[model samples]
Target: MVIILESLLGSMFEALLDYSEGFILRQEVGGVG
Candidate 1:
């Protein structure tokens, strides 16, 4: 159970990072073009 929870949290954090990175990239592209 503990391992499962840890893995879930890790994935969530990774997803959040991916989302934020994409958002920043979009903003940069919009600003440039």
Candidate 2:
């Protein structure tokens, strides 16, 4: 149970990072174009 919760949290953190990176990239591209 603890291991499953840890994995879930890890995946959520990774997803948040991915979303932030993508958002930043989009903003940069929008600024350029």
Candidate 3:
């Protein structure tokens, strides 16, 4: 159970990071390139 929760948390964190990275990248490029 703990392992499953940890895995899910990791995935959620990764998705959040990807979203943040995309947002920054868009800002730097002046568009969502």
Query: Which candidate leads in lDDT?
Result: 3
RMSD of each: 2.4, 2.3, 1.2
* lDDT, candidate 1, at 9: 100
Give lDDT tens digits, candidate 1, residues 1-33. 999999999999999999999889989899563
23 Cα displacement, candidate 1 (Å):
0.2
Span of ten consecutive residues with least summed lDDT in model 1: 24-33
The lDDT values for all models are 0.93, 0.93, 0.96
Mind giving the per-residue lDDT tens digits that candidate 3 earns over 1-33? 999999999999999999999999999999956
Evaluated at residue 25, the lDDT of candidate 2 is 91
Query: Clash number for model 3?
Result: 0
Error of 2 at 1 (Å): 0.8
The whole-model C-alpha lDDT of candidate 3 against the native structure comes to 0.96
Pairs with steric clashes in candidate 3: none
Off by over 4 Å in 3: none
Give the Cα error of residue 25 in candidate 1, in Å.
Answer: 0.3
Residue 23 Cα positional deviation in candidate 2, in Å, after optimal superposition: 0.2
